[model samples]
Target: MKFSATKSTLVYALQIVQKAVSPRNPVPTLSGILFKTGADQLTVSATDLDLTIECTVPVTVHEPGNIVLPARYITELARRLPDVPILIETLTAGSAATISYGQSQSNIHGFPADQYPELPELPEAPALLISQGKLKEVIRQVIFAASTDETRPVFTGALLEIRDGALTLVATDTHRLAWCRLPVQADEIISIIVPGKTFTEMLKITGNSEEEDVTVYVSQSHVFFVTSVMQISSRVIAGKFPPYQQVIPREFSTRIKAVTRELLEATERASLLITEGMPVVHFNLEKDACVLSVHTEAGWIREEMDLQVEGEPLQISFNSRYLCDALRAINSNEVLINMTGPLSAAVIRCPENTQYLSLLLPAQPKPARSE
Candidate 1:
């Protein structure tokens, strides 16, 4: 295969597709990237069985052919090449690839293109087109909460539910949950568990702008995302997510509305005084003010912030990290905290929007002071 492509363009495409290349690939061929040069374009593809990424860039092809070269070497070469056009010619008959730039020459050992595994064929089905910006927003709001541990296979992936005219992305790591909704129009209502790692890669490639709509292909075992010149596919995780709806508190005896940034700052300051074994932060809620207190053998801290409260007085203990994460996720200025009892989970939400809810499990009880 003979092709000439701009160094900058070739480097961009290589960087994008390398997200799927795994160093510990089981198959030797999987470690290399498949390069196919057609009449007008050159394509590079990489896959690790579970996930695949492919990108195409404009190129001048003198001969239409294909080859498989080491992904790592190609990416490094392209990145370091001089700011000029690059010429690549592969001789499959000899299993060699020649890379050239200004006053430079390099030869790389490669495998026949046929040795690479064929990418999965996208089936003809109704696809959903949604703005890349909105899709990325939903992912940012929830992907962080996905369980990093693989013990619970289901929680390691994000639950994508398409119903009516909306798409909901939900993720949880048992301790905290994140949910985001987006407006979408699809012919069919579907639900699938997509691996969080795959979704994150897709987000990285999708970018943040809504310049174009991203096409999503869904099946029982696989999900594919197609952009203008890039495509990503991943194997779906097969399992039912936990019943997340039931865990959110519905009613509360005490409610408080406070500035999100203030609450987050207070929690961060108090968390410093907490120790490793002990992860609890005390919340002393009164009529119109809230006090966050943390104590350790080394020192103690107390933070008081005023808020709008319209319920009975209450004091609760909770994991400082959970509250801080939830507060940081809220985009609005004022946040609402709904507490039912000292031992119950406290529901956190934005006062203006009811679409998002965060639940924090209470910490173990602390010793009471003798009056």
Candidate 2:
């Protein structure tokens, strides 16, 4: 196959699709990117069985064919190519490709396109529709709470729940939880768990074009996110997400309403004193204010922030990093924190009419009676 494309266009597609390249897979072709010739475009694809990324760019095709070139070599080569049209041709004698640019040329051996795994196909109709801006926001607000522990695979992903026209994204690491809700046009209820890394990669590739609505196609085992020129597919995590309703406290004995930014900043400062491990921060919730203090080997930090506190005063300890994550993820100006006791979970919600909340479990928590 032979094709010519400008350096910028070719490099963009290569870099985007190469994100899914398998680093040390047993299948040699999986470590390479597939290059296929279209009528006037070149399609580049990479996959590691669980995740896949593909992109297409305009290219003048001389002969229609396909080849799988080493992702590392091809991407690096394209990055250094000068500002000129690159011509690539594959020889039939062996699975090898010759890339010519400017006055120089490079030959790199590759694998037959047929050896690459077949790309998964999705249903023609989309299961749900959500705006790019909304999806991006949901991912940002919930992905951080997903656990990185591989042993507990279910906690390493975010739960996507759609019920009665409402979409909820919830993630937890058994310590803290993040939940975001959005409205859709669906009547049936469906739930799926998607890996945290998938969300991270999607956020990285999607541009800031909030105007476009992303079409979502969900099968029994996979999901497809399709846009005008891009498609992202990933295997759904196979397991059950914990019932979030059971974990959130329905009623609280203490309610602390404070500025989200101020609280987040103070929590971050207290976290600075913790050199390692999930250190605990003390919260002294009072009638009209809350005091945050941390005592560690490095130093001690004390901060008091004014807020509208109600009910009984309470003292609780929570992981500093977890607390900061929940506060920073909040998009509202003020947050209303509901607490039951020193041992129960503390729920953080916006004071405004928003359907978002985070639940943080206290550190070194004791039973209510034991406390």
Candidate 3:
């Protein structure tokens, strides 16, 4: 295989696909990137059995062929290369390639192209086109809540539901739940569980372009995300996700509306007082303000923030980290907290947007204190 591409273009493609290369891959070829040269472009692909990433860059091809090179070696080399065109040529009989730019050149040994596993074929079903910005935003808001524990497979993935011409993504670690919905144009209802790690990698390649549309294709076992420059295919997690609809509370006895930033800041400060065995932050909801307090053997902190309260007064305790996670995911200026009582789970939502909701389970009861 032989191709000439600009250092910047080749480096970008290599970096994107390298995310799919597993560091501890047992299969030798799985740690390498497959490079295929065409008449006008070079395709770079990497896979780790479950996820695959492929990207193409414009290049001048002297010969149309393919080879698999070490992902780390090639990516690092290209990144450090001078800003000039890079020429890559592979021997016809051996898995050796020479990469040269300017006066620098290096010969690297690689695995044969046939040794690499083939990427999953794209599904023939009609694709769902959605804004890249919206998809990335929804993933960012919910992926953080997915359980990192691999034992419970369902909680380790995010539930993707498409119904009524809308899409919703829900994720939870059994302690806190994040849900985000977006309206889209689609015909059929679809539901699947996607590994959170896949979405985390997708965020890196989607970039910050909001105008671009991402085409989504789902097969029987794999899901594909296609954009102008790159494509990602991941195996769907197999299991039934928890019925998240029943998890969200429908009614509340007390509602507090407060500035999102202020509440987040107060919780962050209060969390500093938390210790190893204790992580609860107390919330005292009054008619005109909400007070967040944390008391531990080390110290005690109380912060009062103004808020608009309705329904009734209430008090509750929650994990400070859970509160911070939900608050950081919210982008609105004002957040609405709906509580049925001091013991029930609290529902947090944006006052201006009804499509997003976060449910946080209350912590263990704190000792009673004088008012």
Candidate 4:
């Protein structure tokens, strides 16, 4: 394959596709980025069995061919090259590629493009168009709650549910859960469990183009996200996501409204006192104020913040990090905390926005002291 393209354009495309390449992959070709040159464009692709990223850039193609170059070496070399036109040509009977820009030239060995696994084809179905901004927001709100442990495969992915005219994304690690809902137009109802890593990479690719629309194509086993110049495909985790609706509390015995920033700050402060394991922050809600305290072998901290309390007073304990994660995910200035009891899960929501909900399981409270 022989192609000529500006260094910046080539670098950008390489950056997008390299996310799918991992050095630890057992398949040697999976560690390489496939370069396919057509009439006026070059397609770069990388895959790691579960996820694939492909990017296309305009290039001057002198000879039309395909080859797979080492992803790490090519990406690094392209990034370091000057912002000038780059000439790339395959050598050694397509076993290697030589990159030249100005006076600098480098040759790298590669595998035949035919040996690379083929990217899954999109099914013949209507694609769903979604606002990039809204998609990114929902992902940021829930992806953090996805469990990193691979034992319970379902917990390692986020559930995307589409029904009626709304779409909801839910993720949980058993300790906490995040749910975000938005209005969307779809002809048929669909549900899929997308691996957490997919969202992480998608967030980076979406960038700040809120006005742009991302086309979503769902197949039996894979999901595709297509943009103007890039396409990302990921294998859907095969299993049933936990029934999250049952875990959400239907009612609460106590409700407290407080400044979102203030609660986050208090939790962060109390976390410092916790030395080992998860930090537990004790909450004591009264008529007009909420008291947060933490006691650890190293030290103890107590903080008080004014709150608009309703219903009965209550005391609850939660992992400080969990509370912080929920609070940070909220975009509103104020937040509402609904508690059923000391042991029940506490629901956190933004008063201004009802579309997002976070549930945090309470930590066990310390026993009372003997007289």
TM, every model? 0.92, 0.94, 0.96, 0.96
Clashing pairs in 3: none
Question: For candidate 3, what is the lDDT?
Answer: 0.88
Q: Go through the candidates in order and give each one's C-alpha lDDT.
A: 0.84, 0.88, 0.88, 0.89
**Which segments of candidate 2 are over 4 A away from where they belong?**
365-371
C-alpha-based local distance difference test score of model 4: 0.89
- Spell out the clash pairs found in candidate 2: none
Q: Which stretches of candidate 1 lie over 4 Å from their true place?
A: 206-208, 366-371
Q: How many residue pairs collide in each prediction?
A: 0, 0, 0, 0
Worst 10 residues of 1 by lDDT: 202-211
Candidate 3 per-residue lDDT over residues 263-339, each given as its tens digit:
89999999887768657899888788788888777778989887888888888899888898899888889899899
Q: Pick the candidate with the highest lDDT.
A: 4
Q: Candidate 2, residue 239: CA error in Å?
A: 2.0
Off by over 4 Å in 4: 206-208, 367-371
Ranking of all predicted structures according to lDDT, beginning with the best and ending with the worst = 4, 3, 2, 1
Per-residue alpha-carbon lDDT of model 1 for 286-338, expressed as tens digits? 88878888877768888988788769899899888777878887878999889
lDDT of each residue in 1-371, candidate 2, tens digit only: 99999998888898888778997998899989999998998989998888888887789999999999999999999999999889999998539999999899999999989999999887777888889988998898888899999999999999998887899999999989999899898765779999999998888885437879888888888888877666789999999898888887789999998889999999888888888876678899889978998876677889988788999999999998888888888888988899999989899898774688889988983233310
Identify the superior model by TM-score, candidate 2 or candidate 3.
3
1-371 in candidate 4: lDDT tens per residue? 89899988898899988888977888899889999998899999998888999998899999999999998899999999988889999985898999998998999999988999988897777558897888889999999899999999899999998887898999999999999999998877889999999998888874336888888889899989877788889999999998999999989989999889988998899899788877788988988778998877776788988778888889889988888989999888999989998989989998978789999999988775332
Clashing pairs in 4: none
